[model samples]
Target: MRSNGGPVIRADIYVRISQDLTGEEQGVARQEESCRQLAADLGMEVRHVWTDNDLSATKKNVVRPDFEAMLASKPEAIICWHTDRLIRVTKDLEKVIELGVNVHAVMAGHLDLSTPAGRAVARTVTAWATYEGEQKAERQKLANQQAAQQGRPYTAGIRPFGYGDDHMTLIADEAAAIVEGAQMILAGESLTAVARKWDEAKLQSPRSKVTGAKGWTLRGVKKVLTSPRYAGMSTYYGEVIGEAQWPPILDPEVHYSVLAILNSPERFSGGKRTGRTPGTLLAGIGGCGYDGCTDTVNGRGYRGVPVYGCKDTHTRTPRSIADDRASKATLARLMFPDFLGQILETQNAQEGQSGAQLQSQAKELRERLDGLAMAYAEGAISLSQMTAGSQAIQKKLETIESELVSTAGIPPLDPVKGVAGLIEGWPTLPLPTRRAWVDFCCIVTLNPAKGRHLTSMSVDDHITIEWRDVSD
Candidate 1:
């Protein structure tokens, strides 16, 4: 039997709001209540209220999760506060109309968006909204450009290891920790160790709260070194902004120095050295003091001892050094007590240019570049000749410069420190230093006492020695 008032269709209610609406504490609630009241007035059966908060509503026919589910559930109709409320965007409104759901907005007239005029109104609203948002964004961009040109402090967001919100500004606490942390790393603290230091020091992340995140790691350290913010610079979408508002955590120079060290495999990838001679300075350096030879060693010496020798004895110069017993004896002799005096002499005689000198050489190369330019201007050189000549000079200069830089100088380990004062001071120095000594010092050879093997048994069992140097 039909009721006195007549049959009522169910109404599925949906609501959506963007991040901007987060400020409006009661917007969603009010929208929901008004729709419910409207549905009741129209004699509709109210079903579920579905909502998406903090979502953009400007898109035409946005496929909101709740809205789609309600449609699929085949509700009898959708009830809303107004027509624009039913569909902020055209596509969404068209979708419901196409699905044949009776959409009724209490304030606005009923719409069978199925017709051309109704569809036209929905599209016009969508287009207007999109245009408005775009124009707003453009205005904001222009304002920012004006601010930057005026040297005002700009900001964007606070990064895990960087600062600034609108522009070149840094949060003080985060900046301090990062700079101190870089120094700690430079001072020989492990990255893991540095992270712990921060935690122990009671510093917090830029988040203003500290309990949630893990401390620094190698990955974290790498990122901090690479960030330009600590060096008093800011970049936005690859555009450089100069003279930032926030104080720089690190002097740009010091920051770059740390960057160099971190990027250098020679500085960081050594892992840890082991044994009496902890480092293999010549580990990657090849022995080429001899003709047509390339050899290397464990820095491991005669027998179980540490010595650098010719790998070519086996591969390149077959049977170069022979007899195990004789080979061991030669190495032991080379480092004999008598060699102590020679070692002292070697240390005292060492001489080379400083990093500054190497830098000066680089300057010379730049001057050479200037010279070429001048020569070209004077018509003293052909274009092709100039190009080839400049390239060749550059290549050779780079090779020498690298060699000078790498082999700069190291005073051979002091023999006096070894025997007279205390223990094997060799253990005190880092392995990298030790490795460098054997790598660049004089050559050692286990050639036949007179270039002859004792017998055929000794032929395949020959021994070899290597030469390292110390120099500029």
Candidate 2:
């Protein structure tokens, strides 16, 4: 066919999406379908089509292959799903219009490019979208700011190792590791050396995987030392603030020292992967099972496997056979709990409010508790909050009804009295308190096999059995 007796060719359709238009949703497919339908309706021959998904609209000018090809081929017309779909910012759009590219939009009925009305519609739509994007960004900024102010992690990406999301915080395991790492780094171990130790010891990344395409990388170590998250603080768009929502990762001193290291010239500033095996978690924690034999390490494995053993067993072949058993027994006795008895004592203690005054103060406490619960349910709260709220509020009752019975005349665990206070002073409390006697208690973990040898037992882990720390 010929146009004005010169030449006529089919229109080539081009579709593009910078972000939020791929597998995330149907934006890409929808754009293509709409473009094809509009081209059919207009009776323009659909010559060829091209799609650029996740390709940024603001990328270098003239970098788009589809755009370059269409221009070079000089089709009779270039049709698009919408103006914004073709050109994001004004500069890019101007280049298209100047190149005689025709635009179309599926929505807005007839936002077209064949006339001035269409161009006006496109401009208004672009303006509104730009405004909406700005507003969303502003809201995110405010939300992140508030999170930081409350001592919560705010960064949306991977957690900077040794910290949680509520900003600068450290959980139990990470905190322990952090304490040790701080000591080592401060002792003048290179950052690269530290990283190597971590790798060798299977100190894996919480955010990333252990192997394959998503495996952990050395970047995790750098994050651990440089991030303020471990310090129980957060930053919003680079503005540091306090009161983080997550539990701190390291002691305050260690956290700040790490930050200082990051800023200082003498920081552990190397990533030495070559010629060195990474570290392990048990490096400093393991020793002989008995105090008398500290020479041989309680090896991590047995029969060529990782296992703890008496350091002096190889040298002092005639040592007492019961030493290992004795060591373990000591550790166990130190950690085990008489669950029911402990619970009874805890319930009887009137630590804070008395059982008699419990009703008077319960309303306010419950309200606060409810708010925390709601936030956690809505995903507005962090993991720490969710866990805390889930386990907190040991007990709640509307009215004291003259008393909450405890173990045989023990004071009631009241909304008023502290659990400890109630239990400690139980003998004098009202007899009705005896009715509140309860049997439930947490089971503590203890290693009966290894016993409590100072040289063999790991801190916290081996002593958790039947151990009652919090009574109320």
Candidate 3:
């Protein structure tokens, strides 16, 4: 059937299902079938079928790729399973009107864009849909608040690393790992180091609920380490509102220590490094180098000149023998040409050996395990001994190989190229990014000049620089 003054009208079929947990087409297929039937009854030829499965209509900034493409296809009209599925919000309703495309909902009937009354009716239906979505969200928020107040564990989001599916009981092995990770962090190991160790051991990182990605990341380690959940507390809107029902994997003291370091002002040095004097190159790592001074040194300017002096001595009424010239000379000496390149090389070596070397070790362990099985069959070893040996070997092999599948698609970046990129982009990079780079690459310590006169010390006598691979 043709519209007045037009040829046979062609329409696109749109179907949506709020969720398809199994990633199957059961819901959307039924919706599409009904929509196709509606198009047949209306005498409109279906030019294309578009679907947005497992996508919510009310989700903000959600990209419905197929729906957008269908609109661009510019069919004479769209036939949806329902008006709510077509446009749940006013922004989307306005877009349909702006496009001048008519809509026909199988449940709600025709929405003609050519007239004001039809547009008003369409907007009213969409407004109701939006209101319904808001009400449901508010109810959910209230329910979560009630659950928190009652000390019931929040059973949503990706399960924490050490917890089982129930979200309260601990998984013994994973729990042990979490406890050990906390101890390591408390013992001066950096978050980057801890995450690298986990990746090397092939520990299974928590899979993302939304993206389905599975792998250990430094940021992920920091989150797991710093979360109040491990401290037996419940947080709502990022505040500790109450104690949780679940047991904690970390001791209270150790948990707090990790948080202190992770939240330290130096690690979070924004536009400039705080707690250190400005315009000082070694502000984050500057220290007193005097043999007997035994006091903390900091970057400060003396007589319009930059220097490192003991905090107490520099603020002294007469200022004893704290040397500014010796500190600057020390800093210059530590700035070796190969310093950054060496750090980059070390980083490359660490992330590089994690792949093939670990794989080879795993392969060797598997072969040894198979040999032990044969030895048992040949009466070379007792059954109990064979079982013990096999268990240990299998565990070792599993640890080494667990991450190979997940990392197969990742390509290694060259350290030289990384350094080159940093150099080229240094001028334009944000201050925080640049500060992060400095903190991760090296640790500088300055000591007061001793034995010889304090004023006579050279750069080598006062400064010590240690390269490191920590990000924070």
Candidate with top lDDT is: 3
TM-scores of the models, in the order given = 0.44, 0.43, 0.53
What TM-score does prediction 2 earn? 0.43
User: All predictions: root-mean-square deviation over Cα?
Assistant: 20.3, 24.5, 21.4
- Full candidate order by lDDT, most accurate first: 3, 1, 2
lDDT to native, each model: 0.54, 0.51, 0.66
List runs of model 1 lying over 4 Å from the truth. Answer: 1-6, 20-46, 57-71, 74-94, 102-115, 148-172, 188-225, 258-472
Candidate 3 Cα outliers beyond 4 Å, as residue runs: 1-9, 17-30, 40-45, 53-56, 59-63, 209-214, 269-472
Model 1 scores a TM of 0.44
Which is the winner by lDDT between candidate 1 and candidate 3? 3
**Superposition error at 307 for model 2 (Å):** 55
What's model 2's overall lDDT?
Answer: 0.51
Superposition-based RMSD of candidate 1 using all C-alpha atoms, in angstroms: 20.3
Q: Which stretches of candidate 2 lie over 4 Å from their true place?
A: 1-82, 108-111, 155-183, 197-220, 267-472
Model 1, CA-based lDDT: 0.54
In candidate 3, the residue pairs with backbone N, CA or C atoms under 3 Å apart (3 or more residues apart, or in different chains) clash, namely 288-447, 289-447, 289-448, 290-447, 290-448, 330-459
For this target, which candidate reaches the highest TM-score against the unseen true structure? 3
lDDT of 1 by residue, 72-131 (tens): 787777777665555665566667767665677766756655577766765676677667
